[model samples]
Target: MPNSSPKFSYIDYNAQTVTIKRLRQLSRLLDTVITVPGTPIAIGLDPIIGFIPIGGDVLGLILSSYIVYEASRLGVPKKLLSRMIFNIIIDSLLGSFPIIGDLFDFAWTANHYNIKLLEKHLNGY
Candidate 1:
């Protein structure tokens, strides 16, 4: 008789863990890792890079896409994937503008949000 229980793949789990760790590092680098000198506010490279002419926002979009790709690999459901893509789209679209977009990037933090979503999904929630 064959076992009916699902067999967990240790290799897959290890791969997923590595991916999550890298994504978390990327999110922190882009979203919130620095403190303003005279204020309590924290910021990251994403908004600062948004000050670049045209390439900055594009770069952000590309970076954000990696998370979505990883999520897909991890077998995230369609609904959650849609939400993750939406977050990236909103961040990219808003971050494409000039001054306003820079401000938006500062506040949006889409990668952080997507990471949270990924965590929720992975946790079987």
Candidate 2:
């Protein structure tokens, strides 16, 4: 009898690796890196950009949306995609506040969370 499992001849694992690596770097840069000096916490461009006004969060949303788009292209399941969207929405909404929003952005790390979701989905978990 012939095997029934679908083949993945067209899937390029190397390309996927490069894409994921780039996404991981972006997530780290946007979420965590700089030390708070006097504290144990670290923050990145996400909170720094949040200082700008409407444009900050908008930029964050755009960058994070790219990750979601890539995940969809990689065949992530609908449920996982929905969860990823929820994370982005939460980050964008809460990170739009005044001083508190910057703090939220520092702690939320939606890009990191979405990457984890993508990894989980790819691993069949």
Candidate 3:
């Protein structure tokens, strides 16, 4: 069967096209997945923002949704998108609590997890 997982296509946010590249294209300066060649200054935002109170965590959750929405728009398969959406929902719901929420966010790498799911389905790994 044809691939049903989502693809990292282009996102027209604010009149600019944003390509969701796994490591670099979608990668930002402070992405969590920094490597040897990656700049230390650009570490992932997971740690930094998790320090914020409820408001900060809420903001993070909102920001994270953009990727999933973009994936849906790219005509990714419903099944894959559903799984990604499920992760996001759970992350947000669990992340809304007090101290435990922060802990959940730290442990739940929803973006990474969703990306892995996409890669797995795409590569048949």
Candidate 4:
């Protein structure tokens, strides 16, 4: 019988190249897409939507978790992965507050931080 599999397989993801590019774009979108007027501070949808009570934090958690999930797929070390998780957990927990949580989100760019960790590992740092 002739092979019936598709041309592209799951192994074709090319995590080192394509995945990194996509993750970088996602990190930027989640953590720094918007710049505060007349200030150096910038933020993205993570905090903006975080103002939506329970659902907002849940959404942020899911999105932040995606970065960690991709990092694991990229073969990031367990130690580093744990650190990334810690960042996400902290972001989710403390960021669940009302006023302070939003403020925390403004300063805590967990996705960006996680991406940096991934790069450091890839760069052998």
Candidate 5:
């Protein structure tokens, strides 16, 4: 019998390392894993956890920071890494607010933003 598997020559599966896969999953878990009923908007644990007061924000920061750490390990340039750090900082600062901060988390999505930065770096953008 002849081989019948389809191939996509343009798809570079090797380009996605294990770290990248984990980061993508983590980003989604932090930013867009849940959908709001009757609305197109989606949210993730980052904001929902932020409702727990001080500890929640700290935990969110820690999780978001891990993305930057992984990006550094992936050899992203220092300049780009700084931008990722800035995103975390902004998210942390604004997200420290009481009610408003939780609302901001729904939109900020620092993990998702940082993943984009990391991908752009990896893609040589």
Candidate 6:
């Protein structure tokens, strides 16, 4: 028999968890694509986050994978999931380069693609 109350607990997703904020930053799914008034769009956090010496960019890539994992848990198809994984791979591999990699991270956004993949899957088109 099932528990009377519940087997699962609820979390207030919008109720101010810093993890949420970090996740958002790691994901970079927001609109507006805010930037310095005159700054070029080619350089941003994608590569900036990778500038953390040795493991910084890799760590950022790892964190980005969480979103894809979530999508998998949500039953996204394996073919599409492969594409998502490929995006992360290309981002991580290219992002592992020295100076250029960090710049690439800034320019390219794997998370944005993952988010889009989810949105498309959700809409079922």
* TM-score of each candidate structure, all chains considered together: 0.86, 0.86, 0.61, 0.86, 0.85, 0.70
Candidate 2, overall lDDT? 0.87
Model 5 lDDT at residue 106? 92
Off by over 4 Å in 6: 1-26, 29-34, 39-44
Tens digit of per-residue lDDT, candidate 2, span 1-125: 86675644366889888988988888888888688899988788888988998998899889889999888877777888999999999999999999998888988989999999898877778
Candidates 1 and 6 compared: the better one by TM-score is: 1
Model 6: per-residue Cα lDDT at residue 109? 80
- Model 5 C-alpha lDDT per residue in residues 61-125, reported as the tens digit of each score: 99999999878766677999999999999999999999999899999988998998888878878
Residues 1-125, candidate 1: write the lDDT tens digits: 86675543333778889999999999999898898899978788888888888898888888889999888878888899999999999998988888988888888989999999999889888
lDDT of 5 at 11: 39
lDDT of each: 0.88, 0.87, 0.62, 0.90, 0.88, 0.67
The CA lDDT at 24 in model 2 is 89
lDDT, model 3: 0.62
The ten-residue window of minimal lDDT in model 6 covers 7-16
| Top-scoring candidate (lDDT) | 4
The predicted structure with the larger TM-score, 1 or 5, is 1
Instruction: Give per-residue CA lDDT, model 4, range 27-72, as digits (tens).
Output: 8888999998998888999999999989999999999999899888
Backbone atom clashes (below 3 Å) for every candidate: 0, 0, 4, 0, 0, 6
lDDT of 1: 0.88
lDDT (tens digit, per residue) of candidate 6 on 1-125: 86686323554444424544454565763212456577555334556657788777767667778877766655668998899999899889988988877666766688887777776775677
Off by over 4 Å in 2: 1-9, 37-40
Better of 2 and 6 by lDDT: 2
